[model samples]
Target: MTRSWIGRRAVVAATFLLALSPLAPAAAAPPVVEAAGAALRPAGAEVVAVTKVAERLTDLSVRSPALGGRVVKVRLLTPDGWNPADRRQHWPSFWLLAGCCGDYTAWSGTDIAKIESLRKVLVVMPEAGWNGWYSNWWNHGAGGDPAWETFHTVELRRLLEKDWGASSNRVVAGLSMGGQGALLYAARHPGMFRAAAAYSASAHPLLNTESINRIMGFFGGQGGDPRRVWGDPVAQRNIWAAHDPYYLAHHLKSLPLYLSSGDGTAGPFDQPDALEADFNRQNKALAAALTQAGAKRLTTNFYGPGTHAWPYWQRELHSSLPILLTALNVRP
Candidate 1:
């Protein structure tokens, strides 16, 4: 490890390694490898350790007791003007959630890092399991690896606010599945975020039987028990409803909301993403519900020519970010 890893990440790596091979001597180094599960995370320990991934990027791992003490990772994109050596000023936060089948790195290489070229805030991207859906699982009513909602809204927020100098003012956004997460978290937490944005979000799971099955199928791919996530559509509709943005839009009346999607048509960017088009419909449907509820601070652009690909999402993030940044009072 270099002098750079001397920061949070290095300390964490050393701590875990020590916990794993306590009897080994420092002179006889153990193979630096990841533990099979939570082998490195002992019980009753809560620590958020940071490791450098790049010049301005860091990988933060937290001991999550909620997920059975599994160490969770969240990648942070520090501001261009950020100086770790300086502790006087704090950065407002912008949390970018990734879609299904994507990890924390999904938001990388996009124009998001340039949202405010002045780099006025910290950008945090937490990993919700590939098919996690960013929801606390029903697990046949035994709500439990991936209690993503608890991880992000509570555990992660506290770690960042206390240790990372993250300000209370914040915004959240995501694309596709993550788009739904942005809306769900904002609504569920009520005042945790000042604003929320979702692009091509899976805004409605109960829109139809087929939509329901399709989402359940994705959840199935993630675990042995698909029904464990939210249970039967008819039987556990409340659980599904709780995770659905359309049903929860009323809770967002006071929030600054940005919703957008295309008709899944071929645009100048690329051909249609079938999944994107499908979810675009979901987004449109959710928009209608929100509108009916008269969500006061809503902004939308239901463009009909794009798909569920990164180009459109990147463009959307760049376009709608002013709304979020302005709400966070960090607009550059």
Candidate 2:
């Protein structure tokens, strides 16, 4: 009996050891990390209730078989009668602009979708990778730098137009840094977009190095030189001037332009109060420069008791929605 007990104990010990062994691969995890305070997030802006036209209208990322290394994540909003197979008449589309540190979800996550439902247009939110600046990079020689212009104008646009059936004529707009990108891109490629808007844009990057440094730090990495992306303000004067939307004042006259900035004094990025004052002054200077440069097709607004926040952006969109819709000839 004692010998039997010993054998049974040995067997139990061996089983325990095997259980502790690290032979198995780890379990797979869900793709997205649920952010803190996300549980209480409310449904975004309101739209007319319609059957969900597409499968799982949520955050999705796709690698381009066409564009090679380009990986794009989109928060897509398909309208009531969307058909991927049918190449029917295209519907008007608005590309949702993402702020610095934002992905494609900014529009759908906020009250943007609710507001968008009021308009009869498709809204596409593309993940313009964190700090991509919407400009293709120079030093990224690996899978290669992001071909943002081509991706937006050619690759993704083609896929969206073919599969989703959005209109060929489009409008683009965004908040803060995205605002800067939208305006700059529209100015550079006048024929690509019909109307554009920027809310609290870091527009006057030419006048100050501090804002440029922030942008450079976001995209080029800490201590990385800015010249590779934007070039030196002094040495590469022409390149810098070309990027400044205000400097490209003649281009602004042709495209529908809307610009807005709150007094930065009460914003999140502001510090020590005095610094916010300086930023507000700089943005004001940019607006003044635009006005002086004979910008005709332009509408500028400076809101009171406001700061650079999603709430302010949401409100601004409400005001701009009618104007943009009218400009695009979409009925209210």
Every candidate's lDDT: 0.71, 0.57
Which segments of candidate 2 are over 4 A away from where they belong?
Answer: 1-60, 65-68, 116-119, 139-143, 220-228, 231-237, 267-283
- Candidate 1: which stretches are off by over 4 Å? 1-45, 80-88, 140-144
Give the TM-score of each candidate.
Answer: 0.81, 0.73
Q: Give one digit per residue, the lDDT tens place, for model 2 in 1-332.
A: 12211222112222222212110101112112112122221112121222343442544355543334555676667655655568875778877688766667676656655554534677777766666666544333334545454455555666667666677768888876677778776766656678888876767655554444434444444334444554454554555566665566556666677777776555543322322233355557766766777766777777644555666677777667765666667775
The collision pairs in model 2 are 45-114, 46-114, 91-167
Q: What digit string (tens of lDDT, one per residue) describes model 1 on residues 218-285? A: 66552345566666655566777778887786787778889898886788877655566667778788
Q: Which 10-residue window in model 2 sums to the lowest lDDT? A: 21-30
lDDT of model 2 at position 263: 66
RMSD of each: 15.2, 18.6
